[model samples]
Target: MSTNFCETATRVLDIEAKAITGLKTYINQDFNDACQLFFNTRGRVIVSGMGKSGHIGNKIAATLASTGTPAFFVHPGEASHGDLGMITQSDVVLALSNSGETEEILKLLPVLKRLGIAIIAMTGNPDSTLAKLADIHLCARVEQEACPLGLAPTASTTAALALGDAIAVALLEARGFSADDFALSHPGGSLGRRLLLRISDVMHDGSQIPLVDEQATISAALLEISRKGLGMTGVLNAQGQLAGIFTDGDLRRILDQRIDIHQTLIVSVMTRNCVTIRAEMLAAEALKIMEQKKINALMVVNAEKVPVGALNMHDLLRAGVL
Candidate 1:
């Protein structure tokens, strides 16, 4: 039984892979015109379809919206019942139908035409009504379905989805859509936190910062490190500028030298010219520096190199940037 199941799964995967690969031939001038139309559209790309095609359309619309092309799905069945009002003259309609003759989607063509809305049809049948009437037609043809019976929409839907992703990514590049722009659309996600979170937002500030004067003993710095629990402390000069940093590694080095922590001034044992970051830097940038330098903590400094804040790998982990 397991052998049969594995063989069937492999067959399905092969069929779907071929389906997606075959979609490359369809990426021609029609696809380019569709992408250009969607990119130049001043309003949203209204995506519509029926059944499984509707499901794929929803995902395509979401991908387009997140990737910088404003888009939303309008179910064809729902559009016939009142949702058609959601589309406007400024919008472009992207209709998906494997057979290219889904009754519900085709029914809206006349109205869409009256509204002066251009239609980009994604279908397996290039000669079908949806394709013939559309302003741009993209062929998402598949030789066979992944299903053994060849009745399911598996291969066709996969081809359509891959084509949609290709168009969205093409538009994303044409528009110069960046990771920062993508982050703005997904502010609640980890990517957004990594891109949008600044060092000042996550770093320990003011009283929370682990700090000691250069004149203070290493013992005092250790106490501050313990109190702040960042595994390190910033040592400040007489002018309150960041002079150096003392971390657990420094303590280990001093211990090897048999130096007395109680008598040693922090500046004498601390790592001077320590790598520091600005408060305005992204927390993700701080993580990169820490990883590259093989350090766990950093001192956030002002323009004058005065210590304003402090952060460690733990803080970045807590902030979801790690």
Candidate 2:
């Protein structure tokens, strides 16, 4: 009577995987019609479902909304109450019900039709009432459920979820959705921080910037770097333009040569023609440059190469772009 749990789990995964693969054949003209319906709609894509289908519907709606096809979910039961008001004639309906005969969902069909809202149906039974009533039926039919007793919504729900993801991705491509657009929809997440943040938003600027005159001694640059805590100092010429840069790494290199930090001028040892970035450039771009060039810090400048700000790996880490 001992149950082999691992064996059962593996079998369940295989069954679910096969069920999702079966959805490939169903992606025919009906799939295209569904995508077109979602893409052409000026208003939101309203998704509704019952039971387990409702959970999948919520995720599907979220995916569509984040991927540039504005959508939201309304429980079929709630839609029968007052949530139906959330949907308008301009919006399209995506209804999910594996059996295609859910009473709650079927109840809304007449009202949605009277309003002239197109319905895209996802169900296991293509011949069921919901499928027949829908303007476009996306058959999510599967050979069997992964449940040992052949009752629970296992493989069937997995197949439905995969099909929903496929439609969302197809619509995303058709809508020309980009990563930046996705970031805008997810501003509170790390991806948003990485994509939307600019160098100016995080860099040390004004008096926070470590700066020294080109004629300043190495000791002066070290003091500026220490006081500013940026590990580097921008050396400016008499014309008030960036002449070079001196860093702690430069100090280490010059230290071995026994160059007197108090007497040696910064211009002689500072790195000239150094890498610089614009304040307007994305902070992610700055991270790319730092990784590619094997550097820890960057100077943010303007069109004239005047040092406007400075940032390091620490700044990016704090901003969650790392």
Candidate 3:
């Protein structure tokens, strides 16, 4: 029984895969026209459909909205009651129906026409009324349903969804949508935290910064590093500018050379002109610099190159950037 079940599942996957592959033939002038219309629209793309098609439409609208194209899904059954008012003349309608003759969707056509809203229809039947009425018609035709009984909308819906993704991606590329732009739409996600989190947001600032004068002895710098627990400290010159940095690694080297911590000036033993990042730079950018420099800590500097803040890898890990 298990073997039979596995075979059935594999058959379903094969049929759906073929259905998605067959959609490539329909990526012609009609698809291009549909994308052009969607891209040029100043208002939102209003997506509508019935039943399973409605579910697919909702996801497509979300993908479009998140990827630089503004869109929303309005159920056709609800649109016939009162939701039709949500669509405006400036908005473009993207209607989905496998047979291209869904009654609830058909009921909205006259009202949509009177409003002068452009319609783009995605259907398996090109000769159907919905396709005939649309300004652009995309053929999502598939040979057969993945369902063994040929009763459920399986392969057809998968084809329609893939086609929707293709359109969304094409529009995303045409608009030059970037990862930072995507992060703005999803600020609550991990990618947003990585891209939008500035060094100022995560770095130790003001009194929390581990800093010592360049003229201070290595013992004083070590005391600051111990107090701050950042495993490092910044050595500033008499002019209040960043002169050098002293880290745990630097301490290891100094100890190897038997330099007396009480007698050596920090400027004489510290790393001169260490790598620094801007306060406004992203924390992810800081992580890249730390990895490249083979260091665990960095000093955040201002436009004038004065050390303003400090952070270590632990801060990044705690902030969910790592």
Candidate 4:
């Protein structure tokens, strides 16, 4: 790598660190008040900025939206050209600018004020017009830019991004937002699959479930396991209650005892205290139980302790819960 490239990277890191440290003082009541305003707003948060600030604003909007807060990004330049219609009195505007004096953002302030929209200004200069005009001001000031020329927005942008995150997280906690709620917003993602997928959704039911009577011979149980392809069979008593479980591991133990599979009753050789999970339980929760017990499969039982379904590690793997 070039020496100049390494030097530039170091400068970037230094400025970003300074920017984060400078944000300590900015985390006071004003930040909380700003969060309250967004949380209470009936309409969406309209984040607006220009250039790099705009990019950061987009991400902040998305984070807020995915975390149970309604939000969307708007371009200040576009707002001036009639997109201001997107802003309403019930909505809150979060304006981002390093100097707090971007002309394009300033142009929309009048319309925003006329509509009675609340403004939360994120700026490096608290004394700037945007700061003075806003209902709440979040100071994203930095000691210096990372740029060698001292004109770029490196430090200031980092401060703004961190402040945005702080607001989103605070609101998330205040609203009692949870991982399950986040998964709802990201249903197509891996997190959603883990939290939303249930054992009933991945478990084998009906004829696919490996089952055998307690009176069944070990050979018969083995045939059921082979036919069901789960490497295990649920042993049910004559009263249709869960008696025990016969798995490949149980067979290994039985063989070690020199038991004859063709003659031994499945219940006599099966594993007692078999681990079982309910069909209504989340697949992720079931996976944790399986892992903690160091097992690979679980029989899904109903309220009466009857085996209604079955699942194994392969089921979790195929469902993306692994």
lDDT: which is higher, 1 or 3?
3
State TM-scores per candidate: 0.87, 0.84, 0.82, 0.86
Model 4 vs. true fold: TM: 0.86
lDDT of candidates 1 onward, in order: 0.92, 0.92, 0.94, 0.90
Cα lDDT tens digits for candidate 2, 1-322: 9999999999999999999998989989999888988888989999999999999999999998999999999998988899999999999999999999999999999999999999999999999999999999999999999997889999999999999999999988987898778878988878889989999999999999989999999898899999999789899999888888888888888878988889999999999998999998889999999999998888888888789999999999999999
Tens-digit per-residue lDDT, 215-294, candidate 1? 99988999998999999999889898998999998888889888888998888888999999999988999999999999
RMSD of each: 2.6, 3.0, 3.3, 2.9
What order do candidates take by lDDT, descending? Answer: 3, 2, 1, 4
Whose lDDT is greatest here? 3
Q: Candidate order by TM-score, highest to lowest?
A: 1, 4, 2, 3
**Model 1 regions lying over 4 Å from their true place:** 1-3, 189-195, 237-240, 263-265, 320-322
Off by over 4 Å in 2: 1-9, 178-180, 189-192, 237-240, 253-273, 291-293, 320-322
**Poorest stretch of ten by lDDT in candidate 3:** 1-10
lDDT of 2 at 6: 100
> Candidate 3's residue-wise lDDT over 37-63, tens digit each?
999998999999999999999999999
